[model samples]
Target: MISWDKDFKIYNFKSKYGPWALVAGASEGLGAAYAEALAKRGLDLILIARRQEKLDELSKKLINEYSIAIKCLALDLSDIAHVIEVLSQIDLPIGLLIYNAAYAPIGDFDTIPSDDLAKVVDVNIKAPLLLAKFVSKKMIENKRGGIVLMSSLAGSQGSPKLVTYAASKAFNAILAEGLWSELKEHGVDVIASIAGAIVTPGYQQAQNAKKAPGTLTPDQVAEKTLKALGKKPTIIPGFTNKLARFFMGRLIPRKWAISIMKQNTESLS
Candidate 1:
């Protein structure tokens, strides 16, 4: 079991998030960024994703670069039961859980198929919810650990084209808030990273226009998120994101906020 200093300062990374860390959706993009960041901190990794080849490729690179032990699980997060079963079989001391996988189906909500909608719920909401439930038990037992759930600023309001996705992300933000309150006394740190537009390959493929305001690199978001983990319940990764959240979530009225979000998302979806 790791000890918390009570003063809430993160004196060491491995003490809290190692000797092992697990990154879901870790094949690329933000997930891969988190994996690299944690590996630099001397944490052996258990990386999860649906593509075995990609996982193995990333695993090889990280092992060569960082010389840290790595375990790759090519399991789909949508299969929550199987994901949990595989994780449970791992004997490593995985004290850090980074849930970054999301299924985003963009378009008019009515135009999207029902199966895709269900997938959105399964991947974005169900997986993390269950993973948190499964992992937090061990964290509380050990009396120290961390959970970083990836949310989005788009979740701050009713984003028209991103309706279901936004709702699911909102769920993550609220879930982390509640978990932070409940787990802090147990020495478990929980944080929600409410990120903005990221300059990721996937985002680039989906983006039809110029870069959005407050667009951030995957590394920037990952680094800022890790830095904020033990200190706050939630963090908006960019200055623009923080300001946007302040205005949309607090200053502006709900209808106006929703309209702004609609305008922003309509073009992309």
Candidate 2:
């Protein structure tokens, strides 16, 4: 993993008129890094996460460093009614939307509870679908916007251990690709970003004793993801991950692919 550097931007995206961006799961990880990057580019922000304290802390830090306007929303996306209320309330002309919140239950499918699976589905799949519909309607009326749906490399294959999570992410990956084809002609850039394992609070909390040699950092993922925004509709954040995806896509049989994913995720956790 590369060290985080404050001065690593290839090109800045300073908005001329304080256009806005919305980042879900903005308290930490790739979401937090994306928030900072957009703030540096002078985009006003609407940050959403389940934790109020983390949101406030991040809001203060961003405002102090970037001097941009910020609004914080503390809501669980799994709570469908609350999510609907929150989206309906956001009045800003959002130029970009980053759907970055997700969760996964770690275990064999039979052992995992239905409630746990449902929660992962709700955030990983439902929230993005609803948020995208809301944002796209507004952007369509205004004639421009962009969206980046956060997916996972595991989504490309099935996993016996993380069954629901993998399926949900797979849904997200394809959903964004379909949206890109539909929205690009409408002056909207819709992208799906398949992120590799990154060093984040959540990852650290769940990390195995034997950590991998080439895990990426959240900032590194964010940097590449931002650069890939309008140019590529489907982006795999790391060179290693991209190459792995390509090689695996060609050589692995479907049943073996699923077994490998299950073994790796369970062993690595």
Off by over 4 Å in 1: 1-11, 207-209
Segments of candidate 2 deviating more than 4 angstroms? 1-18, 207-209
The best candidate by lDDT is: 1
**Cα lDDT of model 2 by residue, 30-112, tens digit:** 89999997887778899999999999999999999988899999989888567767667767777788999989877778888
**Candidate 1 TM-score over all chains jointly:** 0.94
In model 1, state the lDDT of residue 172.
99
- Candidate with maximal TM-score: 1
lDDT of 1 by residue, 107-177 (tens): 99889999999999999999999999998898999999999999999888888888999999999999999
Candidate 2 at residue 152, lDDT? 86
- Error at 51, model 1, angstroms: 1.2
Question: Per-candidate RMSD vs. true structure?
Answer: 3.9, 4.0
TM-score attained by model 2: 0.91
